[model samples]
Target: MQRSIVRLAIGAAVFTLFALHSAGQLRWRLLDRIETFTYDARMRLPAQAQSQAPIVIVDLDEKSLAAEGQWPWPRDLLADLVDRLFDDYNIRVLGLDMTFPEPDGQSPSRLLSRLSDSAVGRLPGFAAASAAVSAQIDHDRRFAEALSDRAVVMGFVFKQSVKSDEAPEQGVLGPPLFAVEDAVDYVAPHGFTGNLQGLQAPSGLGGFFENPLVDDDGVYRRVPLVQAYQGRVYPSLALSVTRAALGGAPVSLLFDPPAKRRSLNLEAVELGPLEIPVDEQVAAWVPYRGGYRSFPYVSATDVLRRSVEPGVLRDAIVLLGTTAPGLLDLRVTPVARAFPGVEIHANLIAGMLEGQIRKKPSYYLGLEVVELALIALLIGLLFPRLSPLAGAGLAAGVALAVVGGALLAWQLGAILPMGVPVVFTLFLFLAQQLFGYFVESRGKREISRLFGQYVPPQLVEEMAARPQVVSMEGDIRDMTVLFSDVRDFTSISERLDARSLSDMMNQFLTPQTRCIQQYRGTIDKYMGDAIMAFWGAPLPDESHALNAVRAALDMVAAVQALNPQFEARGWPAIRIGIGIGSGDMRVGNMGSEFRVAYTVMGDPVNLASRLEGLTKVYGVPIIISEITREALPSDWAMRELDCVRVKGKERPVTIFEPLGPKEELSSSVRESLARHRGALQAYRGARWNQAEAAWLELARREPERRLYGLYLDRVRQLRVTPPPVDWDGVFVFKTK
Candidate 1:
């Protein structure tokens, strides 16, 4: 009962911590980042419905720039382009994704005024001719005339701060949507860069293009639909364009009832029958249809020349912008890294028209709080009574449900807080499990103390969890056993003092032991300079032979690594050999009642010991029996050394030397291995001449390898002695 109480208490504490974070009483930057990351990922998913609203982008692209000269082209050209768009293409609404903060410097009137002030003004007819030309080519007036009474919304910018050297105000701002006092929540700009009075007066509609709610990570996932300037609320370019497109509908603010001691709570912005849900900051999530070029792009040059496909832009809402990098209108958006700023407005306008904008209302916070509370009840109150597996299942189910719910809400044009609830569920589950583990660890500790020395610490923990898997009585099972012994150990030990020899042996045995444990092999015993280990017992590993062979190879490498240190200490460089064999073996605690120890004993174990001794004869670091070779995967590289019957066994067994995994073998080594296989086949067939030739070639190419020389010697001797015709090719060992 006390244990359950402790578990529940831990769960409750963790729940409370995240619940506070969910309710905004506490802040966790990590959770906020996670939320933003998930939001981006969700946005990238295939949208349930693509925006089919008639929206088009009037892109001032590289082609347009090349054909029409550089950006900020003469106002007359813009005026002409505007006329073509309205007269030829019949665009419904046009919104500029650029700001015009100053009058055009290249206007014909300005040029003529400059000319008249020069010495040329003294010439006859100069003033009169200049006046007539100026009136005919006054580009700013012509551009303003093109915009008059049309559904054209000019773009502007909102500055967060005004520097002393910069103008505090520029051009002209359109009428405000509502006074700041009328709304409870808004993002107020310090200053703005509006369109020219001529342009603003002609259209009488302008919207700020600056995004005030770009995420802190510099990703434009959400943008405020409305902002405040000089105590008046203003709409963004997309909102303004949308309003104009809807027959210049009167936009109104929708507010929730004021809370105690709180002002009116802004919820949505309404224009005609369309309602756009917004968060507390009056921001709406960008409903990106896809990546770049989601909307049809009609190059400004093509539009100006009337070369666009007929009906492509007829009655279509167009956003005038540029994809040219030199124009500096690129933005980092959710769907694309270098997205055209104009497409953002197009997507927003389309979203507004189709009613596909996702809403994340202020009440989402309260909803998340409720979610956390339910999770707390499910985990804190119920997890303590369930088993660890059941608790884990519950936690996973809760996470899936939370994510599923969030996705469902998204599909329904809403966004529910997902990251915090999911994180809280995981934390509470882990806390409960950890508490349960500590409380139940006393029995595990006892199991460790009993068998810790014989098996790995991990195995002991497994045994503690499933005590029935391990037994004291001997049982016969198919397994793999490994034996490793240092070469010339007697001679090396004779040179070192007792203390020095002990330290050297300890240094040598530690890494070899670690190799065995890392490969999930159990140490059976350690004789003077030899180590015995086995796999496939206590915890049955199906890859017993493969793991044993891998451990043997690693043990040989470990000994080689220590040789340099030994030589530095004036000790002879050490060499070791390993042998592995697989077959049926008896494994369990064995000995007199007073001194019984966990170990394995059988024919395979004995054969492994003998193979270790034969490593000296073959001059190889590691060897394995035919059974062990058969168990390994084909990826392992092995060379058949010999077929021999030891003194006590009548049946001959094939022995092989491991050349490491095939992938690590050099090309030359692989070639040599192929030749060696042919040579072994010849020797086994009693083809003395062929065998001798193959062995001689191998010995010549690899003079340092003793195995080739040994085989070559055997072939020459057999040729000379001329064995009987009935003689089998098995070599017999008469001694251990």
Candidate 2:
């Protein structure tokens, strides 16, 4: 038990370090899958991508709306359209994208409200107006009575991230037919499942936002067949449409996660249908229509208002929806932007009906695991026994094999999660190569005794796995650079003696440095009491700027707690200036020929120092350049500081002073900034009086600050003695 525990602990520690080191880059977040990621419809693609559906779309176009009596044209008009299709045309099935959620305006209040624009969002007012419509249902009873038993499917949508809090009327269809489901299938640490909103569809089929799962790039690709929603797994619109078109016979879906597959076991003896287009793990490929014109479209008002000339609706399946300006039911498909939502359903129904549904086999993970294990075993267990070049060849061969195999499988209708496995195998291969180097060097030279004792155990394990990483050698990669300096370090250094200064420096640097390390930032080197670090490489971080900003914020908090120690020691409290920037540069061992030292050297590093310089100039503690600002998510609010070029860089980079941890800059500060920037622009344009007036407004709002003060000094000079006529908004720099 002890041996097993120790081995497990060692392995865990090793994997943890591996993850941390590789985690140097931005980690793809799996949080809030529903909100963050929007899906594509790939589940319907396959053999039917080229198939055509004769279903015609009766669009309630803006032109039709303008021609017919505007939107919400009386139900009499809708009834007339339905009657034409049923009696005169005979479309196989009629789908209504518009709902009669409320009364047909038989009530005077509803009629008055409709003409008065007070019914802005009161569509499908069925919930509230059902009682009034009770009489109408009996009166107009003609259309309502016809729909009561008609093969007409109605359209509905959920409240998906509404932009406003305007409460919408609930659909009379009741709660979402879909229920929240348990994790009944494969587990890859990601993928979504919930009970379907409406499990029992009254229509032929129900569709979902099976938005194709295209990579970072948008493309119509793959989709899942059985999406576990609410509690029951609901088929995609295409699947449901296909099943519905096929007369929806009972069939069994068998999922074998261990085998990495799903199958549709058809038992429909009536249709003698054993057409299991869905394969292992109940996934399929979606085929797309040739284009938008592939499906015939007839405006809704045309179908309802009888504008369609005869022969258009004969033997056609009619799907109805709006193309009115107010109805923004448009999606980015290989089709038109004015594409109707019903057409998407039509495509799915057509695909299913034609049995052109392609399946996306789900054994991708299992195959990836086996391949990774094989490669790992081959490299870790056998490749090390070969020469270096042979090992290199083997590793390269492994990578090529993995990539080629995945691509081939993709071509053959399979999409495996090969990213992690391929990465893990490559990591393992490189690790073994590095391990060989470490062992070889150990054999050649006397091993250093117990270096792991001083450093953290985690760091020791990290250093062991790939000792070359620990070597002075470094690689150039884009990383976040952080530079923080004590505001009055010069005065503090002078106040204390050599011992006292060293003590204060150690006292201050220890915790501040630890904070950076805690957030996975590398400590490049410390200058007196200042700390500098980067987030990429040695231990990569995709969110280096974010991480660096977090460390800076945390460092401030850490020093806040340590202020008592400074107060007790009769030393001045430390105020810090932090500047964070993200860019590409060389970060590694750099020293004289006599001795090499580990550090970073680049223009971005220099820019980081300049940004720190701006903190004092701007009277803000933490300043970040626009590059850093761009790297962050939109939620983080920051004020723009200056549009000045740093000393070394040619182009002007915007600088932003990040207000300390939610303590946002006051409105006064913001207004002052607007006036400041305006005055600066004016002053540079040689408009002295205009600049003075703007500066006056800014100064009255906020006290004299360095930036405004600098501009004021320039304005004073211009008022007294104006100089160059060719002046623009360029500030001349004299010092680096």
Candidate 3:
């Protein structure tokens, strides 16, 4: 028991270590990928039902390229496209999905400037040539004019760690959205690539399209709502477009209730009336509805040519990007392998509008730790006491509860850790069950060692398989009980010396015990030459009654076979009477605590012993109660002897002598069984004349059978003094 407790302690310690590691109290790299994958699955769960958001995408797809030639279409064409979006289609806000880091070199104004700077520039007419050329074609200036005084946000990319010798900073940037006085400490990028000055000067704002928080597995599950670069925080494209749509309302960090003993952990970012929940990293989990094409996509050529349906982009927040394979904008995500990167931003914008962005704040980690401990503790204690099948059920129930809780939190726009707690619960349950098995096996071995010599080997092996079977608790089951005693053993014992008598009993008991054990019987105890045994215990036998009867027949045959050997040694040949009864009995380790044995006790067992005594009076080797005969198959041949109330019982039970198989009996034996049944029926019916005639004939044919003679004499006496009319036809036995 002390060793078992020690093993349980070790299991608990191992579970605690894993729980602490999962809670981030210990450093382990093996768990990082698992946690990340768990987060990915959580993000892909179905979001709360929401209306179709006012967000749309203007895709530069293959159709657009076929209609409008290759990309880098002249700057005037891009200017014209921008003009069409705001001036013609009347979009509320337009966000570009691509970047413009360098100026348009193919513009006519650039060509004219390059030609004028060459040797032709020294000519006097070159000034006239330059003025005429620059006046006609300045596409960059024209594109800049198109962006002014409009709700337009351009895209840029950031670098976390820069190694390039070239300048990492370019283009113009506006003031940070969160003021310096606000004192927000967010993650900052090392370098950035912004638009050319000409375009930057006219745009309303710029947003970084590149994600700085992609997970180690390269899946974009969370997008930063806001990021910091060079001590100033900037908004992402999704946030920039949303702010523009809301009429340029300023975005602020929310930390109404700060974390314990630390600076405030960012909880959410608020834009006017719209609040977007965010984690400590100022990122929101992407609420993916499905794969790509979640938002409505309009071809760029259709939009430019005004071929799109009217009012499609009227009040929609439009993102201009390409889906063509050549554009290289595809991304790997949880729901889809080849998800368009532009659709990611569109999803975020829509989520912000509907308040569907789920977040995992700093407090969730503490909740995760608490949940892990509770789940592990529950299954660890539960699994040791239950069967293997029940243990597996408990583990499955814990997993479902954990997963359901996580999903419920997601529905409420909160994130909680799921995988660690679930995995920990199952692992702890399995460990505890395995440890319990090891402990239980040792207990079974102890039982086998103690009971090996007392009971049949079959019973000992059964006890080894299930240690619970050997406990002191008693159980009620239908079982067969057997009792056997050598007839007149006292006379034989007086004739021999003590040593000779001991040798004779040993030789007599060994073969009989062997026959009993070989037929799956459990030896209960031995009283001198009398042996008590039973079946249907420790391991249940549905055919217990049949097996007990067969073992009794085998025991009688075995004793007969040993008679010659006994005579050769000058010892009297043994004759035994066996009694068997079947009924519900209590079987287990039963007795006072001072002295207990695994044995059976009940009325059926007492009756079996009583019937053993009757076998000597009736001159039959075997006597079985009616219940035992009923439990056997129909082919077993048995002759009903009498219905008699025993010494201690009010109810009268019919007893029978078991013969060999019905088909194996001789024709004369079969005719005798029929006539005996008829005579018993007539005797019970009080037809004294017919009963006397049947019994006389049976006695005359089989004069050696004493049972028929005993009944025949009773008929003659009962006829002289007739029984009362109300007699129930039950004979009473005064001796056991």
Candidate 4:
């Protein structure tokens, strides 16, 4: 419970940190960058519907420059192009994306007037003839006449900074949209470059083409629709064009209630029937349709030659701008790098007219805080109770839901914060997972330290998985016990020095212990040169007897394999005898209070020890009691040794020697086993002559065979001193 509280506190702290950042109490640059990235990604997605607003770009491209000469084309040509757009094609409104800051220097009247003041003025007919030509070819006057009484919006630039000695203003600015006393915040410009006086005076419509709100990353994602200058508000070129296209509708600034206006809380820009959303800085989000060339482009040369499609420009709002490299009008936008600046204004004008400008309102910060809080509460309360896998799934689901919600809000013309909530969910999940890992690690370490020495490492690991099921108290369980001891270890230990003896013992016992553990048997303790172990303890195994038997066989092989190395080291070759038995036994931690050990004890354990002693008598490496044999699988190949009563045990228990798996027994071994069984049967039935003959034959076949010789001698004794008829065929050992 305390751990859960710590986990919750950690999660809450994380949420609080992010919430503070969202609520403007703190700043995180990473979150801002990620938010901008997500915004760009959304802008690049395929639009559901193409913008239906009829907007066209009159590109003064390289082709137009080739046909109509270089930039700064004479004002007479511009006048002709304007006439073509307004008269022939019947365009709705024309917005000049380029500014004319000075009068046309190539005007014929200015040139002729200058010439008239020169020595040519002294000629008789020079002044009269120059006057006639000047009246007919005055380019500036003709260009101004074309703009008169036409719905044309001229473009201008706003300077963000100006030097003390540099000029602060140029040309003539259009009428302001609002006074400086208006109750709204706006971007303020230091200076501006407006169109020429004669040009702007005739049209009486102009807008600033500069974007003061370009992001810090140098990407143009949003543009200020209106800026404050010289105590008056002015609209952007796109806003001016949109207003002119809508029959000169008046623009009004919308805002929240006066009480909610804490920090530049302007909401939208109201233009007649269209309500264009604007951020706090009075900037509108550019709803880019795609990359460059999203809108129709008509070359200036084509407009001049009247070679465009008949209906392409009819009633369309046209923007005259140059895409030539020398003109330098390219901008980096969210959808495309090096996008034509004219298309950016075109996209804005189209979006404003369609009422599709996305919004980032002042309440978005509050919404983000709420979203983060709700995500934190849901994850924090549920994560502690869930498993690791379930917790990961919950985190993923929450992240997906957050992103999906943000996308849905984007579709509805609202851009909620997308990166913070998703990142917050991920960080919170990691915190909880790390905390849970550390907490669980403590329990695992305790289990390992306590049981690591007694059981195999794998069994200790298994016990750690479900620690609730592990018990240390003594209890009775049906299990298998194994006892192994080196043959003649007392003599071998005396032959070596103490250090060498210890090394030999370590070398001999390490592999033997590993063999026992390899088959899932747990080592109870190492008794000098002997090892005592059991199976089905600490962790349960139904096949305990089979595992013990297999381990005994492997242990004998392990000793035999170590003999050659021992001989090379001038030590005696080693042999080990292992005995196994299976029955109900008291198993678990048992000892005095000062030194408790997890061990097992019962009659079956004693039986296994006694069997280990008997292996030297039978000259065999492994022996198993009858109960253990019965517990093993039927496919095991074992040879019956005897039914004997060791010292201190009244009832006789049958024992056998394990050969190998049934499928692995050689034919000769099978024949020897069959003959030995026949001999045992005959002897048990008291057929003295037949038993004697069979034992003699087995003894003669292998002179070094101790079991056959011992049986033969027993047959002879039984023949000489025959007991009562009720006597059972059980061998009784007086000494162990």
Listed in order, each prediction's TM-score against the native is 0.60, 0.40, 0.66, 0.65
Residue 140, candidate 3: C-alpha displacement in angstroms: 1.6
TM-score of 2: 0.40
lDDT of 1 by residue, 375-491 (tens): 877777677556688989999999999999999988888888888888888988877777667755665676677667657887876766565576767999999999998999999
Instruction: Give the Å shift of residue 280 in candidate 1.
Output: 1.5
lDDT of 3 at 98: 75
Cα lDDT of candidate 2 equals 0.58
Total clashes in model 4, counting residue pairs 3 or more apart in sequence or in different chains? 0
Q: Write the per-residue lDDT of candidate 3 for residues 1-736, one digit (tens) a residue.
A: 3434544575567667776785678946666676677777776657535437778899989998999889977777788889989888888898998777787877888877887888877888887878976855888888888888888898887877787786777666644686434445556788778888888779868788888788777888988877777657888998999888899987877776643312255667889998898876778888787777878899989988999886788878899988899988999898888999999998888888888887776777678778876776666556555667897898899999988988887777777878777777767776766665786667767876666666687677667645554555699999999999999999989889999999988988898889888888878889999999898876788999888998999999999999999899999888999999899999887778699788998999989988999888778899999999999899989999888788898889899999968999999999999999999989999988898899899989989888988898888889898889998778889977
Report the C-alpha lDDT of model 4 over 444-469, residue by residue, as the tens digit: 78888887877788787677656666
- In terms of lDDT, the poorest run of 10 residues in model 3 is 257-266
How well does candidate 1 score on lDDT at residue 28? 91
Ranking by lDDT: 4, 1, 3, 2
Error of 4 at 69 (Å): 1.0
List per-candidate RMSD values in Å: 19.3, 31.2, 10.8, 9.0
Q: Pick by TM-score: which candidate is best?
A: 3
Instruction: Give Cα-based local distance difference scores for all models.
Output: 0.86, 0.58, 0.82, 0.88
On TM-score, the stronger of 1 and 2 is 1
